[model samples]
Target: MTPQQYHVIALSSLGGAVAAGISDNDLGAISGYSLLSDNATLHAALWYPGSTSAIDLGTLGGVNSAVEWPNHALGEVVGISQTSQIDPLKEQWSCSYPAGSGFLPYTGQECRGFVSRFNRMRQLGTLGGNNSFATGSNIFGEVVGWAETSKRDPTCVAPQVLGFEAVRWGLEGDAHALPPLGQDPASAATAINDVGSVVGISGLCQNAVGALSAEHIVLWKDGIPHQLPTLGGSAWNTPMMLNDEGAVVGFSDRPGDNNGNNFNGHAFLWTSRNGTTDLGTLAGDAVSYAYSINNRNQIVGQSCTPGCASSRAFLYQHGTMYDLNTLLDSSSAGYSLIFANDISDEGTITGLAVSGAGSILAFRLVPNGGWSGSTMGASREGRSLPFRLRAGSFGRIMPNLTH
Candidate 1:
C-alpha cells in the first residue's frame, strides 16, 4: 500500500491535556500511557482497533504506569509502574517527565518493572535495588529492560548511588541481569526477540540514563554480550530496536562528536553483514534517530533540521529516507508529524503530531490497501519536539534510552 492510502486517527486521553503515542500494537489494540484527570499521575492505557475511549490499565498500587512494549501474540504488556513505597532518596527515575508547568519525576514511590496479562499485573523485582523498567517482550513472555542493583556505583550521579544493570525476566517474573561490556557498571536491555536474542546499551552508571553513559551498543546471544560497532563516537551508541533477522537499528554519534558531551548522533542501522551504516537525516536536517525496526527492515524515527530548530517524522526503507509528512496525502491539512515511535509490519505508525491549532497529540497512521476518499496534506515546520513524551508540554525528546 502507498502512503497516500494512510489516514490519521486521534487517540483519547484520560481527561488530560496530553496522551503519549502508542508504543506497541496487539492484534486489535495499541498500548501507551496518558495522564490521569487528576493531572499529577499517569496510567497505562490500551485502545481497541477503532475505539475512541481507552481502557485504563490500572497501576500497581501507585500513581503511574506505562506500557512500553506489548507482545501482541501473547496478549501480554510490559512496562514500569509505581509502588506504594516512597523512595527514600527521592531520586527522579529515568521515566519521569514534567507535568504541565510543573516538572515532576517518578519520585517518592518506588517503581518496578511489570508484566500484565488477563487484566492482572505482576511486578518484576529489581536486582536488590528499588526500581526497574521493562521495555520489550516477545511471544514467549520473556521481558527485557533494566533494574537497579545493590551496588553503589561511583559513576552514578547524586542520590542515585545504586547502579543499574540490564535484566531479562522469565515468564515466572524472575530477574536475570545481562552481562555488561568488560565489567561496565551499568547496562540496559531495550528489545528482545522470540528467538531469545536481546539488545541494549552497555555503559557507565552515570545518571542511570544512556546519554553520555552509553559507550557501546550490545547484542546478547546465548548470554554472551557482543559489542556492535558505532558510527565512531565513544558515547550515545544506543540500539533502540532489534528484529529477529539480527538487524539492529538506532542512533550513534559521529566521529566529530568526540567531545563526549554531545549526543547529536545520526540514525544507524547495523547488521552482521553491513556492520553499521549511517542513515542520514531528511533534507535540510542535521540529525536523526531510529526508534523501531519491523521484521521487513522498515525503520521509523524523527529527524531534526540543523540546530534542531525544527523536526519531522521519517520512514526509511530500500536505502532511502522519506519524510513521513511528505508521504501524507498532498491535499490534506497541514500536520507536523514530529516523532515516529513505532511502525507495525502492516505499515501502521504511531507518534506525536501537532494539529493545525498547534495542540500536541498522539496520532496513528494506518495504510489502507486502497484510497479512502480522505484528502492529503502538506508538511509545515517550526513546531518543537519533546525531550520525553511530556504531559501538556512540548520539549526536545531525547534519544529513547528508556524505550
Candidate 2:
C-alpha cells in the first residue's frame, strides 16, 4: 500500500519583496490569497493578486480587489474590482487567459464592459440606491451582498445608510433584499453556496438601550429567510460561511453559559440533517469560533486558551479537533494564528499570521510529503526570499480530496 502525500501551499514574506499593489507600491507580503485556476493554468494573486502580474484584471480604481474560486467551477475567479477612476468603488472582474479581460460595471452605469471568457460580471445595483457592494459569488454567477437605498437616515452607517439588505444579483441587475425576519432593520449575505443558500447576520440598526437591537444568524434559500436557532444567549449571531450542502458555520452566544456581557461563544455547525451541533473548543478553552468550512465537512477557526493569553487556529474534522499551530514549524516564534478565512476544496488553508512586529503574512498549509521545497534565506535588507515548488505539484497535493 502506498502512503498518501499532501502539500501545504502558503505565501509568506520571503523577507521583503513585499506584495505589490495598484500604485506599484509594496502593500505588505501575501497575507491572504485565493486560487484561480483554469483547466490548464492555476492563477492566484500574491496575497492581493493585483492587476499588474498574471493578466492585469483591472480594478474599480481602489487599492485592492477580492477573488473567490468556486470549487465546482474550475478555471474562473469572481471578485470585486475598481472600475472607474472617478468613483473608485468595487465593480466585478472575471479573469481568464487570452480573453482580453476588463471590468463588470453596475448596470445602468456609464462605464463600458470589458471582455472576459468567463461569466460576465453584471453589476447588481443597490436597492433603490446608487451604490452596491458584492461579497460572495457562486459558480452560477449568482452574486450576493448589501446595497444602498434612496431612503437615507443621517444617523445610519455606510452599509445601513444604504439600507443594508442581503440581496441576490443575477439575470436581473436590480437587487432584491432577502426577506427580513420581522425585524425593523435588515441583513446582508456574506457567503453563498452552490445550492443557492445564503448565510449572514440580521439585526436592528441601533437600540435606545445603547445595545445592538437584535442580531440573528439567518439562512436565505429559495428567496425566503430562515433564522437559524441560536445557541441560547445572544445579543447577536453571525454566520460567516456556508458549504454547498447547507452546512452553516458561525459563532453564537448561549445564556447562563457564561457572563452575559461577553456571552460565551461556541463555534457551531448547522445542517438540515442535524439542527445545530457544537464544534467544541481546544482543551481547556472557554470560547471558540469557526470562521470557514470546506466541502469535506472539515472546519477551520480559532479558539482562545484558558485565561486568553493566546488564541490558536484549529481544524475540526471527523469529530476531531487539532490545533493548527502544533502542525506548523515549531521553531517559529511570536507567530499568532489570526483567522482562517477560506479553505480550498483541496484542503489548502489560507489565513493571516501575525508576527512579532505586528506584520501580518498570508500562509497556505499543504499536507506533509506533498509539496517539497527548501527554505531559502531572506535577501539583503530583509526584503524578499525565493522558495520554489514544483510547477505541477499542486494537483498531486489534493489528488484524492473531495470538494
Candidate 3:
C-alpha cells in the first residue's frame, strides 16, 4: 500500500522552523505560527495555496498565538491567543506555550479562543473565567475547545486554580459549557465536524492543561456526551479529531499502563460501528498518535520511540501503517517528514521536515498532478537515513495545546 508520488512545498517560516496544518477544504490554506522579527513573540500565520508569503494572523494582545488543529471551516480559522488582560488567578492555563517552542510563553495573561474571518479576529469569552481555548470550528462558525469556570476546583493541581469544561462557541461567538462525563471536573473539545459532532477529553482537572485533564475520551452528539472506548488501560485517552462521518482518531494508553503515568499508547481509530482499534506503532515504535482523520479514512500523525524520545510522521491506510518519508517523491528525498499534522480529504499532507544538517521546516505534500500545489526541492541530504521507524518530532504536538 504505497502512496502516490508527492511533491513537497516547504512553507516559509518567520525566522526558523515551526509547526503547521493544512485546511480540510480544497483551497489548501495553511495555518501555522512564526517567530516575529523580535524573536520574542509568535503569531499565527496563514498561507494561500502556491504562495510563499505568510499572512500573520495578528494576536489579541499578549505575545503568543497558535493554530494547532487543522480547522475544517471554510473562510474561518480558530485557535488560541493570549489577550492583554492579566489573569487575576495568575495561572498558566493551557494557553501557555513553553519556552524553546518557536512561540513565546503565555506570560500569565488571560487567553481566549479566537475566530478569524473577514480579516478580523474576535475573542471568544470564557465561562466566567480568565481563559478559554479554541481548537475546532465548523463551517457553520461554531467553535469547540475548553473554557475555565469560576470554581476553584480542588481537583486541580497547583497553579491551576479554576475548574474547566469542554465548550462549544455558538455562531454569535457565545461560549456554552458542554457537560463532562459523570462527575468529571474537566474537559477539552479538540475537533468538530461540519455535522456538529465533537470529540474531546473528560477527566480530572489536574492542571487546566491536558496531562491529567484527559481521562475518558468523549464524543458529543446532539449535545450529549458519550464515553468512547479506550485501548484497554485508562488515562491519556484523547480524541484529537473527528470526521463528518463520525470517525474519531487520537492516542490512548493500553492496558497495564499505570493509568497513563507511562504514555504507553498507540494511535487509535474509533467509529460507532467498529468500536476502537489501536493503529499500533510503526513496528518497534512504542508511542503513536493519530492527529487527523479525513472522511476518506486516511489517518496521519506521529509515532515515537519509547518515552517518545524520537519520532517520525506516519500515514495509516488500508489497515497498514507506513512511514510517510518512504512514500515521498524523489525530489523530497533529502528531508524526513517528522510530524504528520493533518491530511486533507484530497489526500494532501502537511507536517514538519528535517534536513540532515539539522535544519527544520514546514512542508505540504501534494499528489502528482492531482490538484493545486507547487514544489521546492533540496538535494538528497547526504544520503537518505536508513529506512526505519521507531519514534517521531521536535514540537511534540499534544493535540490542541502547544504545551
Candidate 4:
C-alpha cells in the first residue's frame, strides 16, 4: 500500500493587484501582495496552479494594492487597492497601510475595492465616500467588506472622518450597506456562504480600521442581525469565515486581556445545534485564530503566544489542533508553517510558512493517496519559537484582515 504523505508546494512571492479571498480548489492558486523590486511599492499578486512565480495585479493608477482574504471562487478575486485620486479629506483610511511596511505617510490617496478576472482588475466604487475595502466572497460572486458614507462620524477618532459600514456587492458591482447590530455605529461583512448568510462584526466606529470596530460578532441571515454566541469576552470577537453548512470559525478574546486590542483569545467554532465551542490553543500556547473552515468541518489557523507575537500554522480536525510543521515530509527541514490561512473542501491547506532564516513564503499541503489532513497528525508538540508575527495587514494601522 502506498503510504500517505504531504506534497509541500512552496509558493513564490517577489513582486505584484487586486486583493481577494475564500477557498476554491484551484490547485495552489494564492492571493496576496509582494514588495516590488523598487522596495517602495506593494502590488496585489496571484500564484497560478503549480507555478513558482507570482503574477502581479497592477493597481488602479496608484502604488499599493493587496488581496487580503482567501476567495474560494476561482474565476473571481476581490480586494482593496489605491487609486490616483488624492483624498480631499486628508485622512489615513484603512487603505493607507500595507502588509510589510509601516504606515506609508497617509498617501492621501483614495482606496477602493476591486475585482480581478483573467488578469484584469476592475475597481468597485464606494458608497458616497472615498474608500472601500473588500474582505472575502462566496461562490455566488458576492463580495463582502466595508464601505464609507458621506457623513462624518462623531465617534470616529482623529484621522478617520467619513462614516463607514459593512457592505455586500453583487456581480455587477452594485453594493448596499449592512446594518450594524442594535445601535452600533459601524460594522463589516467578513465572510458569506452560498446561501447568502453573512458573518462579521458590529460595533462603534472606533478608528475606522479594525480591532475595536469588531467588538460584537454578528451573523446576518435574511438581512436581520443575529448576534452569535460568544466565547465570553467581547474585544476581538471576529468571524473570519463560515462554510456552507453554517459553521462559523474565528477568534474571540477571553476575559483577561487588559488592553482591548490585545488578542488574548482562542479559536472558536459556532454551529446551530452545538452553539459556540472554544477550540483550544496548541499545547503551551496562549492564543489561536481559526482563519478558514471547509464543508467537511476542517479548520486552519495559527496558534500564537499572546496577541500572536510568535505563532505556528495549525490544522484543527476531529477535536484536535496540530502544528502543521510536524506533518511535513523530510525535505521540509528549513520551513515552519506559521499561519495556516485557508483549507479547501478537498482538504488542501494553504498559508504563510516562515523559514528558519526568517524568510516567509506561501505553502500548500496536499494530501496524497488515500489519506486526508482531517485525520492526520497528533497534537503532541513541544513549544516552538521558530515562527514570528505575521506581517501587519495594514502597517501599524491594523495587524489583521478582519480585526
TM-score against truth, every candidate:
0.88, 0.63, 0.89, 0.88
- Maximum-TM-score candidate: 3
Give the per-residue lDDT digits (tens) of candidate 1, residues 362-388.
677876566455543344453565443
Candidate 2 stretches with Cα past 4 Å from truth are 1-8, 12-58, 63-124, 153-162, 171-174, 207-214, 256-263, 305-309, 329-336, 354-359, 369-403
Off by over 4 Å in 3: 17-19, 22-24, 97-104, 369-403
Winner by lDDT: 3
Instruction: Quote the lDDT for 327 in model 2.
Output: 53
TM-score rank order: 3, 1, 4, 2
Model 4, residue 260: C-alpha shift (Å): 1.2
lDDT of each: 0.73, 0.48, 0.75, 0.72
**In candidate 2, what are the lDDT values of residues 1-403, reduced to their tens digit?**
1112233333544232221111100122222222233211121243333221333343344333334222222233344443334323222211110121222212222222111223333344667654555555566656676555555444343222334467777734446688658754656676788888888666654310111323677888787888888787655455667887888887776676332356466788898888988887877677776767777787777666432334556677777667665555434544544445566566656554545565444555544543133432121111111221110110001000111
Decoy 2 TM-score against native: 0.63
In the range 292-326, model 3's lDDT, one tens digit per residue, is: 89889999988877655567788898998887766
**Lowest-sum lDDT 10-residue window in model 3:** 381-390
Give the Cα error of residue 185 in candidate 1, in Å.
1.9
- CA-only RMSD, every prediction: 4.2, 12.2, 5.0, 4.4
